[model samples]
Target: MRSTSSFFHFLIQKCNRKTRRKLKFSKELLVVDSTKIIVGIGQLPWAPLKGTRAGVKLNVAFHPSVGQPHRVIQSTGNHHDFRSSEELFDAAIINVADRAYAKCKRFDEYV
Candidate 1:
């Protein structure tokens, strides 16, 4: 398995380059969401909250036009979906998301 730091750095570099190349402003909208994955890293002493497991979160940003991902930000399972929205939106030319990401503040900011 790769170390956490190295994996994140690789992901950032890969995603940044791909985002710059693939994302185009053609009146196309993008979608943002997250998924949870179990990492099984054992228990930690300083956990964030109750009922949270040791896992990873996949924060995905994709354009609806071509159905391809533009940006992907990975974080701990405990990280909330909203926490990565700003970065995802900023990277996207147009942003679309599920009801789970329908926060008034984010919607207003995007507008």
Candidate 2:
């Protein structure tokens, strides 16, 4: 447990330093979005879409300053974009999302 935490701490510092060299900002920013990947129904029977198709949704939390995704969540393509949002945001970080993730209830919760 201790080793894992230390490793992540080291990783964060490295990313922050790289980000600082590119852009200066007071708070960390996270860009959140989701995309659907279509597959043959036979490939993944669990994630069914329309006829003959199966799909999965990849929810990505990207750190533009670092030019990489900080977190990723996967679910059935039928899942709504907002479903993964609850886990994508941190109170200390400024999270930016598209219209699909904008929910009045979620905004209130964040406030």
Q: Give per-residue CA lDDT, model 2, range 1-111, as digits (tens).
A: 458447544545655656755877568877787879999999999999999999999998888667789889999989998878888876677787788988899769867
* Clashes per candidate, residues 3 or more apart or on different chains: 0, 0
**Residue-level lDDT tens digits of model 1 in 47-107:** 3334555677788987544547878998877888887877777542657566766678755
**7: Cα error in model 2, Å:** 33
Question: Which parts of model 2 have CA positions greater than 4 angstroms off?
Answer: 1-25
Per-residue error (Å), model 2, residue 8: 27
lDDT of each: 0.65, 0.81
RMSD of candidate 2 to true structure, Å: 9.6
lDDT of 1: 0.65
lDDT of 2: 0.81
Which candidate has the highest lDDT of all? Answer: 2
